[model samples]
Target: MLTRKLGNTGYEVGAVGLGCMGMSWAYQESSRDDDRSVDVIRAALDLGVGFLDTADIYGDGHNERLVGRAIAGRRSEVVLATKAGLVVDDLPTKAMHRDGSPAHIAAAVDESLRRLGTDVIDLYYLHRIDPAVPLAETWGAMAELVRAGKVRHLGMSEVSVAEAEQAHRIHPVAAIQSELSLWTRDALGGVDTAVAGPAAAGAGQAGSGDVVRWCADNGAAFVPFAPLGRGFLTGTLHSATFEGSDFRAGSPRFQRDALAANLRIVDVIRAVADRLDATPAQVAIAWVLAQGGHVIPVPGTKNTRYLRENAAAVDVVLTEADLAALADAPPATGSRY
Candidate 1:
C-alpha cells in the first residue's frame, strides 16, 4: 500500500500499478470470467495498489470495460490509467499493429473514455509508437485530450529517449512503461536518461537497485509489471509443464535449453525463499520492492490463492546481503524478447 509521486503530475498512485492485459487478452488465450477478474481487481484496490493499467487494444477493449466495471462504484478511491495507440479493434485479419497518428489518438481516446466508463482518465499512454507517424503529432493529439478535460496526463511505452523528448515538446509525459526486470535489464543508462528526460514525470520500471536510484534522483516514479516474471519465479514452471501457447512458451528463457540452465537461478532464489519461509514468487516480489522505497511492483494473478500470497510480499523484506546474493546469480541464458 505504499505510494509515490509520478514525476510532478500533481497526481499519485500506488507505487505499483496492475497490468490488466493478461486479464482480457495477450500472454495466453483464456476465458473471460469477468466476475473473478473483477474480484481480483477489487482485491488489489483494497490492498491500496490502485494504479490500474489497461489498453484499448487488449481484448478489443474488453480489458478497459473490465477495469471500468471493477472500479464502478469505487472509482474515487483508485487511480485509473488506460491506453491507446495499439489498434486491436476487430482487426480484419486479426493482426496486431500500431497507430500513433494524430487522427488515431484523437478517435481512440473517446472510445477508451466510453469503454472505461470514466469522465477523465488519470493517465493515458500511447501503447507503442507508430513508425509511420511522427511522435510529436501523436503527443499533440494527446495534448488536445488534456485540453478537452478527457485526459489528465499522457505517457509513452517502449520508447527511446529521442522519441520521449520529441513527445514532451508537445505535452508533459507523466510516465514511461517498458519491460525492466532482474533478468530483462534495460540497456545500461537507458532508464537514467528516460527518468531525467524533460517531463521527469515518471519512469515505469525500476525493479533493480540501479534503476530505482536513477528514478529517485531524476524525480520519476518507477512502476514494475511482471515482477513475478510471468510465473517462472513463482516456481510453478518446470520444463515438462512449460510447453504451451502462453507468452512464456516462446520466451527464450523458457525454452528447453535455456530453462535447464535457468533452473540454477531458480535454485538460488528458492534457497533465499526457504530461509525467509516464503514462496519463491513472494521472495521475487519482495526483492523488487526492496530495490527502492519508490519502486512499485505489480505482480498479476487471476486466482485468489496466488493473489493472497503475492499480497503478502508487501511484508517481506530482503537484507543487503540477500540482495548481493541475488545479484550474484549466474547469468541467464537468453534474451527477454
Candidate 2:
C-alpha cells in the first residue's frame, strides 16, 4: 500500500484506511461476527491499512472495544482514530444526538481511551459539532486533552470551511473528515443539505467552501468517509433489498426507485473500471485519491476479501480523461442522510 501523511502529525499512514463502524454498528447487524471482525482488522494492519477509524457512538462503544481487542498486541503498528460527541440514543434504530459540551467531551475521552485500551488516542475527532453547545467550548476542552497528553491530535467531522477556520484559530485542525465521493462532493465546495444529526438544522448548511483546498493550504489532511458510496458505487448492488437493521434500508438513495435510477452512476464507474482493468470499487476509491495528496479515504468493511480488495485501490491510477468522465458522471439521486 502507498503511504500518505496523517495531517501534520508526522505519522505516515496507508493511503487507504479502514472504517470499523459496520463491524458493530449500522449495516447488517445480524451478520456481525466479533472474531471475524478482529481477524479483518489484524489483516488490515498486515496489509499496511493501519489508519483505523471508529466512533464511540458506534454500537454504543462496542466497536471501540472490538478494535481494542484486534490491535491489542500490535498497537505500535496501527494509527488508532476514534471519535466522541455523538451519543447513540437507540442501538436498534441507530438514533443519535450530538453532545459536544465540554463536560461530555472531557468524560468521553477517558471512556474512549479505556475502550480502545490505549493511553492516548492518535486522532480524536468531534463526531459532529453540537448545535446546543458552543464550538469553542467543545473545542477548548479538546485542546486541553491535547495539552494533558490524553490526545495527540484533534479533528473535526462534517464541518464547514468557516467552522474549520474558527476551530483552527483556537488549535491546529489536524484533520477534517467528511462525506466525499464521486456522488457526494460537497466538501469540495457548495452547500451540503444532506447532512444528518444536529448539523442538519443549521450549522452544516453553511456552505463548505473548497474544504479540500482549505486543508491543503492550512497544513491539514482531508479524510473522506464512505468513498465507495456505501457499496452502491461497487457495481454489485442491483436491488434495494437490505436487512431491516441495515442503515441503507432507510436511506433515500437505496430506495427501490432511487436505486434503479442511481445505477446510471455505477454505469459510468464501471465503464472507467473496465477500461482501467480495475473493479468499480477500485475506480471509485481511486477517483477519491486523485482529489489531493492530503486526502485519505476510509472505506469500511467487515469482510476480509473486501478489506484486501479495498487496500489494493491505492495502486489504481486514473488518467485525466478518466477523471473528467467521472467528474461529469451523473449526480446522486437521494439525500445522504
Candidate 3:
C-alpha cells in the first residue's frame, strides 16, 4: 500500500484509509457483523491501511468500541482518528443534530477516549460544525484538548474554506474531511450546495473557496469521505433495491428514475476501469487520489475483499484521456444527501 503524510502531524499513513461508519451504522444495518468488522479492521492494519476513521455518532459509539477492540493489542501500529460534535437524536431514524459548544467538546473527548480505549487520540475531528455554535469556540476547545495532551492533532469535517481559516487561526487545522467523490466535487470548488449536514451551508457562499487547494496551501491534509459515492461508483449498485435501514433507500440519487440516469456516470467510469484493468471502485478512489498529494480518500467497507480491492487503488493510474472523460462525466441526477 502507498503511504502519505497526514497533514503536518508527522505521521505517515496509508494513502487509502478505513472509514468504519458502515460497519456499525448507515448502510446495510441488517448485514452488519461485529466479528467480521473486527477482522476487517485488523486486516486493514496488516495491509498497511493503518489510518482508522470513526465517529461517536456512528451507531451511537458502537463503531468506536468495535475499532477499539480490533486495535486493542496492536495500537502502536495504527493511526487512530475519530470524531465528535454530532449528537444522535433518533437512533432508528439516524436523525442527529450538531453540538459544537465548548462543554460538548470537553465532555465528548473524554467519552470518545473511553470508548476508543486509548489515552491520546491521534486525530480528533469536529464531525460537523454546529450552525448553532460559533466555530471559534468549538475549535478553541479542541485546541485545548491538544494542549492538554488528550488529542494529538485537531481536524474539521464538512467545513468551508473560510470556516477552516477561522479555526486554523485559533489552532492549526491538521486535516479537513469532506465528501469529494467524482460526483461530489464541492470540496474542489464545485457549487453543489445540497450536500448532507453542515458541509452544504458554505457552498457558493463568500469566503468558502476550493477547500482541497486551501488545505494543500495551508499544509493540511484533505481527507475525502464517500470517495466511492456510497458504493454507486463501484458499478455494483444497478437497481434501486436498498434495504429499509440502508441510508441510500431515502437518498435522492438512489431513487429509481434518478438511479437509472445516474448509471451513465458509472458507464464512463467502467469504461475507464476496463481500459486500465481496474475495478470501477478503484478508478473512483484513484481519481480522488489524483486530486493532490495532500489528499487521502477513506473508502469505507465492512467486507475484507472490498477493503483489499479499494486499497489496491494506489496502483491504478489514470491517463489524461481517462481524466478528461471522467471530468466530463454527467453531473449527478440527485443531491448528494
Candidate 4:
C-alpha cells in the first residue's frame, strides 16, 4: 500500500487507515468480539494500515483498552491516535457530553495513556470543542500536553475554519477529523444538508469555508472519518434493518425511505467500481483519496475482510471521467446523522 506524510509531524502513515470505533462501539455491538477486533488491528498493521484511530469515549473506554491489548508488543509498528474532550455519560444509552476544561484535558490524557498502554500518544485530538469553554483555554491545555511530553502532537475534530484558525494560533492543528464521505461534504465548505449525529453541533455552520483547503495551507492533515458513509457507500448495505444499539438504527440516512434514496448515490459508486474492477468500498475511499494527498481516511470496521478491501483502495485510482460522474451524482436524501 502507498503512504502519505502525517501533516507537519513528518510521520508517514498508510494512505488509508483503520478507524477502530465499530470494533468497540457504534456498529453491530452484539457481534463485537475482542479477539476478532484485536486480530483486525494486527492484520491492519501487518498490511501497512498502521494509522489506528480511536477515542476514549468509544464504549466508555472499552475501545482504548482493546487497542492497548492489540498493539501491546508491536506498538512501534503503529502510529496510534486517540481523542479526548468528549465524555461518555451513559454506557447503555451511549450518551456523551463535552468537557474541554483544563482539568478534564489534564486528567483525560493520563486515563487515555493508561488505557492505551502508552507513555506518549502520537496524535491527540480534542474530540470536539466544548461550547462552554473558550477554545484557547482548551487548546492551550492541549499544547501543554505536548510541552509536558505526554502528547507528541495535537489535533481537532469537527471544527469550523474560524475555530481551527483560533486553535492553530495557539498550536499547530496537526489534523482535523470530520465526516467527509460521498454524501457528507460539509468539511469542503459546502452546505451540510443531511441530519448529522449528536456531535454534529460542532460541525461548522453553513459556509464554514473549505477546511480541507485550510489544512493544506496550514500544514495539517485532513482526516475524513466515515469515508464509506457509515457503510452506505459500500453498495453492500441493502437493508435498513440494524440492531437497536447500532448508531445507524436511528440515523436519518439509514431510515427505509431515506436509505432507498441514498442507494442511488451508491449505484453511481458501484458503476465506477465495476469499471475499475474494484469493490464499491474501494471506489468510495479512492474518491476521498483524490481530495488531497494529506487526506487520510479512517474507514471503521471489525471485519478483517473489509479491512483488506479498504486498504486496497490506495491502489484504486479513479479517472477524471469517473470523478466527474461521481461529482454529478444526486445529493443524499437524509442527513448524515
Candidate 5:
C-alpha cells in the first residue's frame, strides 16, 4: 500500500486506512465474530493498513475493546485513532446522543484509553458536536487531553469549516472525518448535507464550506468515513431489503425507491470500474483518493478479503475521463443518516 502523511503529525500511514466500526457495530450483527474481527485487524496490520479507526460509542465500548484485543501484542505497527463525544443510548437500537460537554469528554478519554489498552492515543476525534454543549468547552477539554499526554492529536467528525476553525483556534485540528465518497461529496461543500438521526440537531448544517479544501489549506488531513457510500458504490448490493439490525435497512438512501434511483450513481462507478478493470469498490475509493493528497478514505469492512481489496485501492488510479464521469454521476437520493 502507498503511504501519505497523517496531517502534520509527522507520521505517514497507509493511504487507505481501516474503519473498525462494522466489526462490532452498525452492520451485520449476527455474523459479527470477535475472533474473525481480530484476525481481520491483524491482517490489516500485516497489509500495512495500519491507521485503525474506532470510537467508544461503537457497541458501547465493545468495538474499542475488540480493537484493543486485536492489536494486543503489536501496537507499535498501528496509528490508532478513536473518538469521544457521542454516547450510545441503546445498544440494541444503536440509538445515541452527543455529549461533548467538558465533563463527558474528560471521563471519555480515560475510558477510551483503558479500553484501547494504550497509554496514549495517536489521534482522537470528537465524533459529533453536542449542540447543548458549547464547542469551545468540549474542544478545550480535548486539548487538555493532548497536554496531559492522554491523546497525541485532536480531530473532529461531521463538522463544518466554521466549527473546525473554532476548534483549531483552541487546538490544532489534525484531521476532520466526515462522510465523503463518490456519491456523498458533502465534505467538499456546495450541498445540503446535514447528518440525520439522533444527533441531527447537532449536525453541521448545509453549505459548511469546502472542508476538503479547508483541511488542505489548514494542514489537516481529511479522513472520509464511509468512502464506499456504506457499501452502495461497491455494486454488490442489488436489494434494498436488509436485515432489521443492519443500519442500511433504516437508511433513507438504502430504502427501495431511493436505492433504485441511486443505482444510477453505482452505474457510473461500475462503468469506470469496468474501464479500469477494477471493482466498483476500488473505483469508489480511488475517486475519493483523487480528491486530494491529504485525503484518506476509511472504507469499513470486517471481511479480510474486502479489506485487501480496499487496501489495494491506493493503486487504482483514475483517468481524466473516469474523474469526469464520477464527478457528473447523479447526486445520491435520500438523506445521509
Candidate 6:
C-alpha cells in the first residue's frame, strides 16, 4: 500500500484508511460485539492501515473511547485523527449542536486526547464550521493546539474554498474531509480542497468544484468520508435491504421511490463489475483512489466481510476505459445526507 502525507506536515498514512464511525454509531442503532470490531482493526493494521479516522460526536465520543481501547497497546503504529467543533451534549447520549468557539476547541481537544488515550492527535479537524463563530477565531484555537503539541495538524470538514483559504491563513490545514463519490462529484471540482459542498443539504457545504485538484496542487490531503455512499454503490441496498432506522432510510435518495429509481445507476456499476471481474464496491473505491494519490476514502463498515472487501480496493486498478464508463453514468442518485 502507498502512503500520503497529512497536509504539509510530516505525518503520513496508508492511502486507504478506516473510518471508525459506523463501528459505533449512525447507519443504524448498533454497538460492537465484544472485540469483534477490534479484531478487524488489528487485521487492518496487519494489512498496513496506518491511518484511523474517528470523531468526538460519534456515539457521543464512545467511538473514540473504543478506538482508544483498541489501539491501547498499539498506539505507535497509527496515525490517529478525530474532530470536534460540533457543540455536542455533555451527557454523551443526546443529539448535538455546533460550537466553533476558540474556548470550545481548546476544551474539546483535551477530552478527545483523554478518550483516545493519546497525548497528541495526528490530525485534528473542526467537525463542522460553526456559522455562529468566525472561522479565523476557530482556527486560531486549532493553531493553539498545534502550538501546545496537543495536535500535529489542523483540518476542516464540509467547508468551502473561501473558508479553507481563510483557515489556511490562520494555520495550515492538514486535510479537508467531505462527501465525495461518483454521484457527489461536486467535491471533485474543488470542495474537497476546503470542505464538502452543497450546504442546503447540510451546514457549511459548497459545490464540488475542483476542490480535490486544489488540494493536490497544494500538497494537502483530501479525505472523502462517505466514499461508498452509505453502501448504495456497493450493491448492498439492492431492494428492501434497508430496514428500521438504518440512516439511509431517512436519506431522500434511499427512500423507496428514490431508491427504486436509483437502482438503474447500480446497473452501470454492475456492467463494470461484470467486465472487470471486480465488485461494485471495489470499482467505487478504486475510482476514488484513482482520483488522486492524496485523496483517501475512509469507507466505514461494521461487517468484517465488507471490511476486507473495502480494504482490497487498494489493489484494484481502474483503467481509463473503466473510469470513462463510470464517469459517463448520468449521476442518477440524489443528495446523500
Would you list the clashing residue pairs of candidate 5?
Answer: none
**What lDDT tens digits, residue by residue, belong to model 6 across residues 1-337?**
6776666878777778899987776666555553877877777777778689999888788889988988988999999989998754533233467888988898899999999999999999989888888888889989999999999888888776777878887788778887787666767663322223332323446563567777787678999877887778888776645545465665668777778887777778778878878899888888888888788888887767887888888878787898889888766445555
Quote the lDDT for 173 in model 4. 94
What is the lDDT of every predicted structure here?
Answer: 0.71, 0.91, 0.90, 0.90, 0.90, 0.78
Q: What ranges in model 3 sit over 4 Å off?
A: 195-208
Look at candidate 6 and tell me the lDDT of residue 240. 45
Backbone collision tally, model 1: 2
Between which residue pairs do clashes occur in model 2? none
Q: Report the CA-based lDDT of candidate 2 relative to the real structure.
A: 0.91
What is the TM-score of candidate 4? 0.97
1-337: candidate 1 lDDT, tens digit per residue = 6576766677666655677777875454555488998998998888777878888877788888999999999988777777887775343223456778888888898998889888999888888776678777778888999999999888777665566667766777667666555554452233221232222222232222344344555455556667776667777778634324365665567788888887787888888899889999888878777766666666677776777787777777788778888877776676554
- Name the runs in model 6 displaced over 4 angstroms: 89-94, 190-204, 240-244
Candidate 5's C-alpha lDDT?
0.90
TM-score (all chains, Cα) for each model: 0.85, 0.97, 0.96, 0.97, 0.97, 0.92
User: Can you tell me which runs of candidate 2 are displaced by over 4 Å?
Assistant: 193-206
Candidate 1 matches the true fold with a TM-score of: 0.85
How do the residues 139-189 of candidate 3 rate in per-residue lDDT, one tens digit apiece? Answer: 999999999999999998877888898999999999999888988888888
What residue runs in model 1 are displaced by over 4 Å at the alpha carbon?
A: 89-94, 187-214, 240-245
RMSD of each: 5.4, 1.7, 2.1, 1.5, 1.3, 3.1
User: Which stretches of model 4 miss by more than 4 angstroms?
Assistant: 194-207
lDDT of 5 by residue, 1-337 (tens): 7999999999899999999999987888889999999999999999999999999988999999999999998999999999998887778887778788988999999999999999999999999888888999999999999999999999999888999999999899999998898778888886955565554533555677799999999999999999998899899888998888898898889999999999999999999999999999999999999999999988899899999999999889898988998889999898886
lDDT of 6: 0.78
- Global CA lDDT computed for model 4: 0.90
lDDT of 4 by residue, 274-322 (tens): 9999999999999999999999999998889999999999999889999
